[model samples]
Target: MQPGQQPQPSGSYYPQQAEQYAVPPMIVPSQMPMMMPGQQYGQPPNVPQHMLRHGYIAATFGTYGETAYCAFLKCGLGQIPLMFSIPGCTGAYTVAQSVLPHLPYGWRAADGAPVILLDCIIDQTRGPVVPQEVWMPNSPRVYDQHVVRAVLRPPTFFVHTDGSVGLPLPQILSGNFAVNNANAPVDVGRSSIHLHIKIHGYTDRKRQFQTQESGQWIQLRRLVGHVGRAVDKYLREAEPDPEQPVPRLRIGAGGIVPADVVVVGVVHVSSGSWMPILQLTRALA
Candidate 1:
């Protein structure tokens, strides 16, 4: 067929005026023609142009919608192996032909579910994407630098209503900031300035929620803006004590916190509000 020239239909061609006909039986995987090296599996050479145009490819080869398989392909991995095993089956042929092109390089299905790749582990309990360590055979220096950077950085905290905090930002951002009161609340009167302010709710009037059901944590950069507003509200409500030096909160153009204060933890209230706890230290002279 010429490039972009629509192929004409042959054999039992149903014109627009033809009466409805019975649907054909589905072709099993074994009955489908073997895919040539350069040919796309679904678009087999033997299949009629009309059948391929009507999505017979998917119907004949089965669905290509496996989660892990799709994710593996999205990461730019090549074709799935033909000899691997799948759960409840002995060989790869049991899997749909369409899904075969998307499976991870060496991974297989387990209990009819996608097996996690070693370089990208999925946390089943938390249902959150967790970072995995990747090894680079040829780039040792780059890998070492990445490891050092990851280790030195502190985890982002999510403050709960009861003045407790959760570590690592991902869970909190995903709306899992439930209250954990084990950790003590920061003492505001300590020698070092530790700013602990309860985030009651959004300052935006239109987005306000009940005090009991507030505190879903967003990105830390956005949270800093809310913190600024909270501090302003506190300053307006209370009288200025002469002995206490005003705590200065400075965020750089790129949202880097000044050295004086470090974010410690985020507390989620029973009512679903989030509070941020910051530990303040003397800035370098």
Candidate 2:
């Protein structure tokens, strides 16, 4: 093979092709190959043109699109280590090839499914031509500052009808998050969100609060962006703006609330219609 010349297909090419790969539109690192030490920025020949490289993927869906290892994630319930696969290619690099994200414990119910926000860090610096597959499937944009991201299964891309997430990609997530109410009639676009998240059983300091002297705008910084729009890019472009409300994790003057009380909220996407807005509510039974 020569520079810019595509390599021959591997035996599993059909399976690979059948397995659709989508890079979320969120913050992604440059797909341009990162040069090895002592090599000129664009010079060739650190290795053989015929040399092949291997990469890995942890996915919710699989060959033939059966939601293979992510069976439990279908209804947004259950827990298990994510499924991953490793394969070789003529030009690519792999880091944390065995990485897998675990679902948070105890989030299943009937009234609704808990919205799980996801993200990850993807670096594709070793491929010369194509982006070497550092992606988070369902996240919104591709910012180097923002980690890579994704969702359980498309379930229609699992994105809101309004496109709140920005772009679509398959997901395995990371980062702090929040949610929208599942039973809402519409987007329920709330301007403010306050969540009493379960930190830990022993966490004595709960309920975030700002000093009386602080302005409401100043308080917005303490709270993370809405997790329902957890993967959206608008939150990252600039400093926190109070107008775009976020989930405030307050520390009450009375101290921490009991951890046994589980609170979970999510923006729901069903067959077609979607309600992506969120508000604080008790965990569904």
Candidate 3:
């Protein structure tokens, strides 16, 4: 599937002859409002409607320059910092990846693309202060101050299961398990299921935040790392007995065996950290 596209069943975990399911409509860029820098949008009391949709304030850098542009998003848990830097005269810029957990699940655009808030601050004086490079040789910059909608791809999941059936890790983690029955008649009685999941392409860059202890910069790797470790520990604690053999099903009066026992074993895959990036662009006003 393409980046940011919804997952399709592979029949690896579903029962055969299962019917196809419909995914919810994706959020498109046109559905969101466009605003310029310093323009006032949102309800009274200083709350934006888009922020209400995701239950958190979204912020983006409205200005750019040759050296670097920095901004922050105020997630309820913590502040997510973003930095975009241009090293050389090639005009190429690298955006700092922002990481936050529990973002509204399945919040995509009307075109089935993922939707991320591009915070547009109209007040140039009040918005994020763009650091100026005085002695820099290359002065690359973008002067437009407007909001635009953009797209971003989603992450990939690698699932390891030791049981009578294989299941998609994303669906299971997202609590959408109905698709598991699309392949064959799933025998829910089998209790030997243990799942090990690894996610890829979540975060591309290391992020940092200020701490109370003398305002030191610290990497945000723990957010993703803690989750992986917690999941691993949970699966290990729930592991089934190693010596038990998988039970076989017998059919017909002659006791003929038509299907082999589906005993799956979990294979160890490399684990790593992930922090997803939100691709943004200037939407036409």
Candidate 4:
């Protein structure tokens, strides 16, 4: 099947004679509002609509360079958008639409001016549901300001999952998952079926608040270190230092500093009745 095309049942996940999975047609970008940076377009606040709150989690980062491989995510922006009918709710959710940031390597807030990128919209419905219109930020809720820090350095692009360059002692990657189905099927009485959903992606460089004198994009360095080092200091303090004679030295070789960069974590959503405890599976998966 094509990358975007939904896979037809070869009797794998579903029965061959059973009805093919229902997949909504793709929504054309043109029919939707023209999504461009600095362009004003969105639905009015007065319009009655279901609000979905979403958070981006980093899945993985392989390298650091001009063209590093990274992945960002778009989850349900509101509370669970879809649910299963079973007493324990269970089912699958295909991404219908999403709005993501067009972040590229080396793209910094200093070089990007206001540091605000375009709001990408992905409509995953069968047809156009709303008219195309430009958005004006007249209220706080409609266009909320999300101040994120670009804490990590530009990702180096030499790493791969194949263990080609000799696996690093510790593997660190960032990304998140979006699960629409939570409950289980109601008809399962004598049979046992398991469903495991895993979503992984690389973390992208986000814009910071700082700007260059020319009004171009410039990044703040301190923010980057904050996300990278804050945890280490916490761990050091928790460790038993036998040589420590002074009462918690504030200034020392290992000092705890807040990270400035926004370290995005790659998220995984795994669910099943006997799906090996959530914490254990995530640690190993």
Candidate 5:
């Protein structure tokens, strides 16, 4: 094939064009056609074009339509490993030749999901085309002198509602604020700052139950923003600011105090193919 002349289609992953191969199967390095030293391979090959030469390269999605594996190869040529993200999805693939060459051999996810390795190095003497984020604390933005230790202070209960007595229950939580009263409706103002919390137990008489009654504890998840709003709603009368302020929530007579406040997340993995060259580069890195 002449330079820049597109090769014939292998197959496609799309349902309508199902016969077209998006990415050709991986080729073992030992099986690759060997060229003798000083032989005319012409000039040093462009990685992406070299991928094109192989035929049936694959790709994943992005904000733009059907982005092929260009960036993956770029990372390989740069001797860097990177992750390719396709939003709202666990797997996706595209078709093209040579695109697979950038991927690594024997690449598989430790988590047993599909992944690709990209390994090729580009000459950086020409200057980097893109900059990576590097953390530098003393880089002209802020100058630091010495380290100092500040004593941890107790939670400040600034907003106390009238007609309600506030009792700071120190035994309930160490270095944290807790409010309790036998009767007069305790309004613990949500501190303006967000907090991480877990409800160890609660006492209720009429329901005749406590965290001890049921051995099982209910796990509650809360976001900082939502928790702030809930606190504002419950302690409405105690809010220091009235404009755009949320009220404190009132815990009902029979309602249970939340078990905990930390949020949990899940990661789902689906099966798919990734560029082998990209996979290889990542593995070596």
Candidate 6:
């Protein structure tokens, strides 16, 4: 079967994989989004999606260049929107969608810009559904922001199990392609994917405050950092060492076998913790 096509039973081999160089298909191959970066002739099988043993990833984001460009886009006047999310009680920690800045309303910041980590308490009684954004409880619960020094750079490319890029590792690149899969050479260096970020502070904790929620911010303010105070000045948080390397979030890292699933792992965030997650992009089950 061709790449992007419906997944088949395991131990399956396609002509291209078996042949060092495969002949063009009788018909053009379907351009499925599952196709990896260098994949021009064919795409990887969705079968591996199921075989993933590690936790899974749910979101897709652009490369570092995209991240930088997004940070500079101007709103109506001079404000740049800040983006971030909470990822609910349980879900893909969509690094790209969440972990953003530019909220307009809410607590002011300290000397530097605000880098708030609000672990908002959820009323599970409302069920297991929680929006990935900062879910503020309406009752009367205050949120605490734990600002950290660095954070994991979200992986834009397919990150393998060994923290390598390209060629899903566990896949036995059968036939001529075996070496390419085995060597797992880094066609693109890994440094671009591993990035760090600076956190800031915010002030004012009125129950109701305007948030920088609009992706299309028609009217923006001065895009400044290190210019505010901590949220709820009373809640004093221990200052973390900013000298440490920022942590990174690898959203989708898959491998071979049913146990080998796409996982969500954080590098350099306290004790490294990895969990099994589901891949929403490629159909596994």
Measured against the true structure, the TM-scores of the candidates, in listed sequence, are 0.19, 0.17, 0.16, 0.18, 0.17, 0.18
lDDT of 2 by residue, 1-285 (tens): 233332232222212222444421111124324454567766663331111111111211112112211221332112212211112111221112112223331121223333222211122321111111221213223311121122222111122223122111111123222222222222211223222211111121112222123222212112222332332321122233243243122222232122211111122121111112111111211
- Residue 209 in model 2: lDDT: 28
Evaluated with TM-score, which candidate comes out highest?
1
Tens digits of lDDT, candidate 1, 1-285: 333333232312211222222212233333344444467756534222212222221221122111112222222122222223343222122222233332322224655444422111111122111111111112434423322211111112333344332233333234344433323232111122122342111111112222211333233434433444444443234333343233122233332123223233322211122333333232222
TM-score of 5: 0.17
Question: Residue-wise lDDT of candidate 6 within 161-268, one digit each (tens)?
Answer: 342222211231211111112222221112212111111121212211222334322111110000011111111332333442321211123411222222122111
How does each model score on lDDT?
A: 0.27, 0.22, 0.21, 0.19, 0.21, 0.20
Off by over 4 Å in 6: 1-150, 156-169, 172-285
lDDT of 5 by residue, 191-245 (tens): 2212222111111111111111133321111111233233223223222233323
Q: In model 6, what is the error at residue 139, expressed in angstroms? A: 21
For model 3, residues 33-64, the per-residue Cα lDDT tens digits are 44433556562322232232221012211111
List CA RMSD, all candidates: 24.7, 20.9, 24.9, 24.1, 26.4, 23.7
TM-score, candidate 1, is 0.19
Q: Where is model 2 poorest over a 10-residue stretch in terms of lDDT? A: 48-57
Q: What is the lDDT of residue 257 in candidate 5?
A: 24
Worst 10 residues of 1 by lDDT: 128-137
Task: Evaluate residue 94 in candidate 1 and report its C-alpha lDDT on the 0 to 100 scale.
Answer: 23
Give the per-residue Cα lDDT of candidate 5 at 77. 25
Error of 1 at 159 (Å): 13
Q: How many steric clashes does model 4 contain?
A: 59
- Give the local distance difference test score of model 1: 0.27
